[model samples]
Target: MADDKKKKDDEVKKEESEGKKDADETTAASSKKKDDEPKKPDVPPVIAAGLRLERILTVSSPSGGSAPKAAAAGSPHSSDSATHNAAALTANVEAVLHSNPGKIVRRWLGTSSGTSSRATLADLSKGAEALLSHDGPCATGRELVMLLAPPTEGGGEAMDVDAKAGGEEKKDDDEKPKFLSTAAREYEAWLISLAVRLLWRDGRHGDAHSLAGKGVSILSAHMDDAARVTARAGAAGSLGKAGGASGLYPLLSRMHRYQSLAAEGLAGEQGESARAAMRADTAAAHRMACLRRDVDTQATLLNLMLRDLLNANQVEQAQKLLSNSTFPDSASNNQLCRYLYNSGRIQALRLEYTSAFSNLSQCLRKAPTNTGLGFRIAVQRLLVVVQLLMGEIPERNVFFTEGMVAELSPYLKITQAVRRGDLPFFKTTVAQCASRLREDGTYTLISRLAHSVVKAGLRRLNVSYSRISLDDVAHRLGLSCATSAEFVVAKAVRDGVIDATIDHAGGYVRSHDLVDVYATTEPAEAFHRRIAYCLTTHNDAVRGMRYPPDAYKRQLEASRGLKGKKDDDKTDEEKAQEFEEEMDEDY
Candidate 1:
C-alpha cells in the first residue's frame, strides 16, 4: 500500500509542474503581444501640427506631465464644447474660402483682430488640416495661416520643406499652381512674405533671400497682368480698383525690405552679388512705389534704404536718397516718425545741425507716446548728441527718463562733460563710451563735439575774465598747444559765437561786453521756426483728415441746388414765408 501511495504522489507532482510551466508561457506570450503592438499617442496629430506651426518647433512638446491630454480626457463637457467650436470654425473657413475674391478680401481685412482670440484660434487650428487642399486659393490661404505661426525646435530647412503642401518637395517651379483670382494671388503674396520672415527668423538668410526674390517676381507678374487687363478694358476698367493692386504695394515694399535684409545677412558669404541684389530690389520697389503713388510704401522703403546706407557707412548715398525722394505728407505718423529719425541722423552726419535738430525734435514729438520704448530711446540718444554738437546742453530730465536710464547713461556722462566745458573729462568719457557710441552709430557725431566743448570753454572765459592768454586758454581747454587755442578763438570770434577779439601780437583773447537782449534776429528766427512748425502741423492735420470721396462736391451741389429755386413764383406774403423757411433751413 505504501509503495502505491509514493508512486501516485510523484505523478501528481509532475502534472502540477507541467501546468505551472504552461501558465508561465501564456503570461510571456501576452506581454510580448502587448509590446509588439504600437501605442496610440495621447496627443492628436491636429493638435501637434497646430503647436508646431504656432510656436518654436523645439518647444512644441507638452512640458507639464500631459496636462493638456488630461484636461481633454478629464471632462466630457470640455470635449463636447471643443468639438462644437471646431465644427463652427470649419464651417466659417469653408464659407470664407468659397466666397468671391472681393468678398474674401473684404472679410479678411475686416477681421484684423479676429486672430487674437484664443478660442477662435484653437477652433481654426483644429479644422486646419481638413480645410487645406492640394491646390487653389484655399491652399494658399492655409499656407499663409501656417506661416503666421512663429517658430520651434526644428530648423528652418525642415520647416521649409514641411511648409509645402502635404510636406512633399516641389518637383519643379513651372509646376506651381495658378491662382486665378486677384485675392488669391494677394494671399499667395502674403504667404510668401510670411515664409520669408519665418526663414529669416530661423537664420536661413540664403533661403529667405531666394524666396523673397521669387515673391517679387511673382508680384510683379501679377501687377503686370492687372495692368494689362486694365489696358485691354480701357477707360471703363480704370475705375475698377485695378483688382486691388493698392493692397499689393505694401506687400511689395515689405518683400523688398525682407530681400534686402536677407541679402545683407549673406553679404559676407555671397559678397557683391548679394549687395547688388539688394540694391536692385530696393530700386525696383522704389520706382514701383513712386509709380503707384503709394506714399506709405515709398516712405517705408525710403527708411529701409536709408538704414542700409547708414549701416554701410555710405552717408552720401543716404543723403542723396533723402534729397531725391520726397516723404509724402500723407504717410502714417509711424512712417513719418521713422523718416524724420533717419533724416536727422543723416543731416547730423552731414554737419547740418540746425536741420538735424529740427528733424530729431519733430521725430521725438511725433513718435507714438504709448509704445516703442526702444525707438524713443534711440531717437533721444541721437538727439542728445546732435544737441551737444550744436553747442547746446540737453535737458537734465532727458537722461533720467523712465525706462531709459541704463541705455542713456553713457550719453549722460558725455553730456555732463560738454555742459561743464571740461575737455579732458569729455575726451575721457568719449574714450570710455567709444564702443557703445559706435554701436549706436553716433561715434562720429560725438567726436565732433570736441570743438563744441572748446567753444563752450571760450564763452565761459569771456564771461569770467576781461582777457585770457592763448597759452592759458590751451591749458584750460586741454588743447595740445596754444596755437590751436588761438585758431579756435579766432574762429569763434569770426563766427560770432562769443563777444571777443583775438589779439595775435599780444597772444591773448579780449572779452567784450555782452550784447543787449533781443538786439539780434535770434529771437525772431526762433519765433518764426515755432510759428512755421505750428502752421505745418496744422496743415498736416488738415491733410490727414479722412473724408468720403466727392464729399465737398456733394455738399456744394446740394447747397447750389437749394439756392437755384426761382423767387418770382410767389406773392409778398408767400415770399416772406419762403424767406422764413430758408432762414429756418439755414439754421
Candidate 2:
C-alpha cells in the first residue's frame, strides 16, 4: 500500500508541473500578441508637425510628487512622453530667445503685487533694447515702410526677381535673415511701447521718458513713411498738400481728449489738492521732449512751451520757437488758421499792429467760410480795434460776413462809434459790450481802443474848429477835466493825427494848418506802399510754390491723353521732344 501511494504522489507532482508550464506558455503568447498589436501607443506617437501649440499651454509641476507619480503610473509609459515633450519645448523656446530669454509677454500682463511682474517688464524692455541694437538684423527708422509698402510699388516684386536669379538656395539664404529682421523690428516696437506704458504706470516717468526718447527716431520715421506712402498712392485724396497733417489730427485729438477727460475726472474725484499734482505731472510730461516727440505730441508741447514763454514774458524765445524747424509746418488748413490767429494775438499784445493785421487777415482767408464762427468772431473783434488803432476804418462789408452777424454786433457798434468820432457813443458801446469783452478776455485790449476814440474826436474837433476851448473839448470828448483835454491834445499833436498845440495856461487848444493828403513826389505814398506790398506778395508766392513729386508722371499721363487728339497733327518726334527734358528728371 506504501509503494502505490508514492507512485500516485509522483504522477500528481508531474501533472501539476505540466499544468504550470502550459499556463506560462499561454501567458507568453498573449503578451506577444499584445506587443505585436502595438501596445496602445505609449507617448502620443511623436507628432508629425513639430511645433504643437498645446505643449506651450500644458502646465506641469516640476515637483513630480505623489499625485503626478500616481497619474504617471496610471498612464503606463505616458510619464516618459510628457518628460520628453517638456524637455524638447524648453530647449526650443530657449533656443528661440536669448541665452537668458526672460519671461514671455502677454497683453493683459498684471503685477502680482510682487517682484515677478516688474521682472517680466524688465525682461521685455531688455528684449526691446536687444532689438534696437544695430548688431541685430532688425529694421531701423523709416525702413519700416518696406513692410507696409504697396504691392504694386516698392519691394513687392523683389521675391520674383530673387527667385529667377538664384532659385531656392538664395531664397533660403535671404528668407531666414529677412524673417529675423522683421520679427526683431516688430518685437522692438511692441516691447518698447509696452515698457513705456509699464514704466509710466509704475511712476518711473523719468525712466519712461528716457526710454521713449531713444525711440523718437522710429516714431518720426512712421510719420515720414506714412506721408511718403500717401503721396505715392494718393491715399488721402482732397486732404491737399497738408500731407499727413490732417490725417494725424483725429488720432491725436482722440488720444488727448481721452487723456484730458480722464485727468479731469481724476481731479474731480480727488478734489483741489489733486489739481496741483495733476498740473505738475502735466508740466513734467510736456517738458519731456522724447515722450512728446515719440507720440508726435510735440505740437501740443510747442503750444504749452509757447504759453510758458509768454507767461514769463520771454517774447524772443517764443518767437524763436515760431521760426524754428522744431515748429511744425502748419500743413492742415485748420492748423494754419489757428497758428496765424495765435501769432496775431501775440503781435496785438506787443502792439505790432501791422503784423497783427496781416496775420489776422491770413487767418480769416484760410478759415473755413460760413464755419469757424467763433474763430472768425475773435479775429474780427481784435481786428476792428487794430484797424482803428492804425487810423483805418474797416469796410461795412466786413461786418456782414456770413455766420458773423450776431457775434459781431458788439464789435460793429464799437466800429461805427469810432468811425463817426462819437466819444460818448463809443463810451456807451464799450460799457454795453463790457460783459462780452470780459467773457472773451479782450476787455483790457478793447479798452486800449478808448485812447483811439479820443484821437478821432480831436481830429474831428480840429476839422470843425481851428481853435477850441480845452473845457469845451473836455465836454465834447467826455473827459473828466480840462487837464485831461490838454493831455489828449498834446498826444494827438505828437501822433500827427491832428495838427494841434496845447495852451495849458489859457486852458485852450489851437489847431495848425492842414497839409495836402497827396503831396508825395512819386505815385502817392499809399499807392507806392500798395505796390511794394504787391511785389512782396508776388515774391512770397513764388517762394512758397513747390512742384509735386509726381509732376513728371502727370506730364507723361497728359502726353498720353493728348496723343489721341494730337497724333494726326504732330509726329512722334515732337511729343518726344517735349517729354525728353522731363524724362531725365524723372529717372
Candidate 3:
C-alpha cells in the first residue's frame, strides 16, 4: 500500500514538469514570429496625401462624385485588371493623336469619316485632289487619278456593294471629263492637261479626249489671258497639232485649225454623220498638205491615206508603203505574214483554192513557230480541202509522222468518226476539237466522210452502226464520251485496225476484208497474220520489181522466212509498224 502511494506521487510530479516545458516552447515560438515579421516604412504624410489625391482624382468625375457610379457606367461588369489596361490604352492613343496633328488628320482621312462607308469614284477623286493640294506638288495627283479610274475588267465599273447602292453613282447625265471645263476649276489645270497628253501617249484616247475637253471648257469660261493662251495651246496639242494659236497669224491659221478639227472628227466614230466627218477631214488633210511643212502633220496625213486604202481592200498600195518603210524587221515580218494569211482567207472565201493555198503556205513558212502551228494547221486543213476539191488525196500520213502521231491522232480520229457517219461520235469529236481548232466548218466534209465509212462498215456488217451511238458507248463505259474522237480512235485502232476508207466516189466505205478478219476467232491474231502476209508479199513484190535476178532470189528467200515464222512473241507495236510499212508499199 505504501509503495503504490509513492508511485502515484512521482507520476503527478512528472506531469507538472512536462506542462511547464510545453508552456516555455510556446512563448519562444511567439517571440520568433514577432522578430521575423517585415517592418513598415514611415512614409511622409504629404507624399501619402498626394497619392491619395491621385487615386481620388482617378476615381472621381468632373462633378466631383464617387468612383463607384463612374466605374459601373464605364463597365457594368465587375471591374478587373483588363478594364484598367483598356483605359490605359485609350489614354495612350488620345495622347498620341494630341501630339501629332498631321498624323491624326491623315488617319482621319483614311478612315470612314473622310472617305465615307461608301465612297464613289467622284468623291474619291475630289478628296484625292484636296489631299494633293494640301500636300503640295507631287506625283500624288497623277497616282490618285489612276486609282480613281475604273478597273479594266468587268466593263470598268465599280464593284463595291456600298458604292453601288448609293445615289452618288455615276449618272447618265454626267458628261465625260473634258479638259476645258476641268481647267477652269484650278490653277493645276495644266497638270490635268499634261495627264491627258500622257494618257494619249499610252493609247487611252477616249480618256484623254474627255479630260482635255473638260480642261478647255474650264479655261475658256475663266478666260484669264495667260490661262486662255495656255489652254488653247494644250487643246491644240491634245488634238495632235502644233500648239500656239494667238494673234493675226494664228487667225490666218484658222483654216488649218478647221482642218485639224476635221481630221479629229474623222477618227471619232463611224456612221452617216461619221462619213460626213471623214469627208470633211479628208478635205482638211489635203489642204494642210498644201500649207504646212509639219512633218508630224504630213505623216498623219499619210497614215489617214493608208487607212483609207486598207479599208477599200487596196492592200497592195498599203503593202508597198510598208515594204519601203524602215520598220523593225520583226514587226515587218509579223505584219507581212498577217496580211498574207488574211489575203489567203479572202481567197478561200472566194473559192480560189489554188491562190489561197499558195498565200497560206508562204504565210506558214514565215510565221514564228509559236504563232505558226495554228496557222500551219489552218493552212494544212485548207490545203486538205483544196486537195479534196481538186480530186487529189491529201497526204495526211505526212503529218502523222512518229513524232507527231500523238498530237495528230486527235484530228485523224475526228476525221475517222465523221467518215463513219456516226453523228453522235462526230458531235463529240467536234466538241473536243473546238478548243484546239477554231473553225468546225473547215473539218465538216472530213467528218462527214468518216461517218460515211463507219456507216458503210456497219452496212457491210448488217449491223446499223448508227444504232451504236456514242451515248450508248458512254453509258457502257460509265462516263461521258466528252473525250476527243482522236482519243476514241486511238483506243480503237491501237491494234492494227483501219476503221474505214474514202472510196473513189468520195463516199466512205468499210474495208470488208478488215471486218471479216475481226469477225474471226481472236481477231487480233488473225489481223496479225494478215499484216504479216501483206508485208511479206509487198516486200517480195518490190524486190522482184526493182532487183536483179540474183538479188530477187535472195529477197524472196528472206520474205519466205518472215512469213513462215508463226511465233506469237512479237508485240502489238512491232506488228502495227510492219502493217504500216506494207500499207505504204501498197499506196
Candidate 4:
C-alpha cells in the first residue's frame, strides 16, 4: 500500500513538471517573435496628410467605385468596420507615398469637386484629427512639410513625399518619381486650410485664424515657386491665365476669407475695438478678393460688410459703401436681392420714398418665392411701408400673403390705420408694436409715415366736406394746433395728395369737384402702364430663362454647323455659276 501511494505522487509531480516545461517554451517563442518583428515608426504629419489625401482621391475616383459603406453607429461591427477601413487606408497610403507630390496634387485637383464623398471625407477628417492634434513644435503647414523634407536634400527644394524604408530595393527609372517644389507647397497649403476649417468648426477660432495665416504664407510661397517655374520655362507676361499657381488662387482667396471671418468671430460682439478689428479684417479680405478677381467672394464680402454696418446703425457708412463700390449687377440673384433690400432701406431713410418703393418692389420680386420665407417677409413688410409713404394704398392682399400673414400682422395694423385716416389709432398702433417694429428694423422708417397719416385724413375730409375750419381739422386729424393742420394741408395740396386748396386768409380748406375718371385719360394711362409692366416682366423672364447645363452650348454648336453647311452649298453654287460664265465668254 505504501509503494502504490508513492508511485501516484511521483506520477502527479512528473505531469506538473511536463506542463511547466511546455508553458516556458511557448513564452520564450512569443518573446522572440515580438523582438524579431519590427516596430512601426510614427507617421509624420505631412506624410500622413498625403496618405489621407491619396485615400480620399482613390475612393472618390470614378473608376475606383464606391467606398465600403460604414456600419451604423453603435453596431457591434462598427469598430471592426472602422478598423478594416483604417487598415485599407494605410495600405493605400503605403502603396502610393513613393510617388512625388505633383502626382498627388494632380490626382487631388482632378476630382470634380476637389473633395471626396462624404464617407471618405469623414474618414480623412478623423485621421487629420489624429495627425494635427499636437499643438507645439510642428504647428504650421511649412513646419509639417519640413519634417518630411530633409534639409540635406538641397533645403527641401526637391522634396519627395516618400518616407524612408531602410531595406527597400532601388526602384526602376520609370517607376521613380521626380519632386516638384510647387506641388509640395500646394499640398502644404491644402493641409493647412483643411486644418483651419476643422479648427473653426470645433470652435477654436483663435487657432483657426493662426493656421489660416500660415496657409496664406504657404500660398505666397507656392506663388513664388510658380513664378520661378514660369521664368525658368521662359513663359512671358505676368502670371495670368496660364500661371502655374492660378489653380491655387481660389484656395488662397478662401483662406483669406476664412482667416478674416475666424478673427472676427474671436473679436466677439462687444466693444468698438472689436468692431474696428472686424471691419479691418473684412476690408483685407475684400482687397484680396479684388486682387484675385474673385467676383463671387467680392460680392459676398460686400454684402457682409453692408450688413455689419447696418447692424451697427451706421447708415451713412452703408450708403457710402454702396456708392463707393457698385454692387456687381452680375452678382447672383440672392446677393442682388440683398443689395436691393439694403439700397431700399437707405433710400427710405433718406426720405426718397419713390426710389425706396421702386427698390423694395424689385427686391420683393427678385426674392425667391419658394424659399427664404424670412427674406421675402422682410421685403414685403418694407414694401408696404414705402408704398404708404408714397401716398399710395397697398393692395389688400399684400398683408395676407401665404407664409407671411403671421409675420405681416403688425404691418397690416399699420396699413389699416393709414388707409382709414385714423391718426389717433395709428399712434396707438405704433406705440403698441414699438418693440416689433424695432426688431424688424423699421422703427425709424415707420415714424416718417405720420405725414402719410395726415395726408390720409385730408383726403377723408376732402371727400366728406367742401370746406372745413382749421380748428375742426386739428380736432379730427389729431394735430397739435390749427396752424400745424393748415401747414400740413397746404403741403399736401402742393404735393397733389388731395384736389383741395388751403385758404389761409379764411382759415379753411376747400375741395375741388370730383372728376369723372372715365371722362379723363388717367384710366387709359393706368391701363397702359399695367400692360407695359406686364410686357416688361414677360420679356425679362424670357431673357433670364436658363437652359440645362451644356444645353445652350449644344444648341449654339448645332446652329453653327447648319450655318457652315449652308455657306458651303452657296459657295459651290457660286463656283458653278462662275464656271458657266467663263464658258460663255470663251464661246
Error of 4 at 301 (Å): 2.3
lDDT per residue, candidate 3, 1-587, as tens digits? 99999999999999999999999999999999998998786633322322332233333223333322232222212256355433322332222211222222223223322223233444434433432222222233435354545555663355665565564456553432211111112223323433454455555555554554444443333223322343443332211112111111111222233222333433534323544445455546445533432232333344444445444456576556545533222123544565565556555545566666666766766777754565566555655555443334446684574445555555676555434445566567777776555443354344434434433334433233422343443433333452433244334434334453323243222333335645667778657757965785587467556423355765676788853353356778687665544432321
Best by lDDT: 1
lDDT of 1 by residue, 1-587 (tens): 99999999999999999999999999999999999999974654333333323222112222322222332222223345445333322222222221123323333433422332222323333333332332432353455445445455658856765687573454564444221222334445655665676678778889888888878877776666455443444322231232324446656766877887788788565845787657766777778777766665687888888888888799999998888878876666788898899999999989999899989998999898878999999999999988888777889999999999999999999888877789999999899888998888888888888888888888888899998899999999999899989888889988888988888899998898888859989899889989988997898788778655556875786778743344445578787665544432221
Candidates arranged by TM-score, highest first: 1, 4, 2, 3
lDDT per residue, candidate 4, 1-587, as tens digits? 99999999999999999999999999999999999999988864444545555355444433342221221121122345445433333232222222232334534644523342121323333333333312211134545433332134363523342434432346664443322111233454665666666667778787777677667766766556555545555442333323445545545655766775677667545334555666886788678656644455577778778877887789899889988986654456777798888889888887888678877887888888877999888888888888888778888898888888898998889898998888999999999999999999999989988888888888899999999999999999998999999888888888877898878889998899998879988799779867977886798687677545556765786877874665466776586665544432221
Q: Candidate 3, which segments miss by more than 4 Å at Cα? A: 1-331, 370-384, 397-587
Residue-pair clashes per prediction, in order, are 8, 0, 34, 0
Q: Using TM-score, give the best candidate's number.
A: 1
| Model 2: how far residue 61 lies from native, Å | 47
* Ten contiguous residues minimizing lDDT sum, candidate 4: 67-76
Clashing residue pairs for model 4: none
Task: Go through the candidates in order and give each one's C-alpha lDDT.
Answer: 0.67, 0.54, 0.42, 0.65
Number of the candidate with higher TM-score, 2 or 4: 4
TM-score pick, better of 1 and 4:
1
Positional deviation of residue 102's Cα in model 3 after best superposition, in angstroms: 50
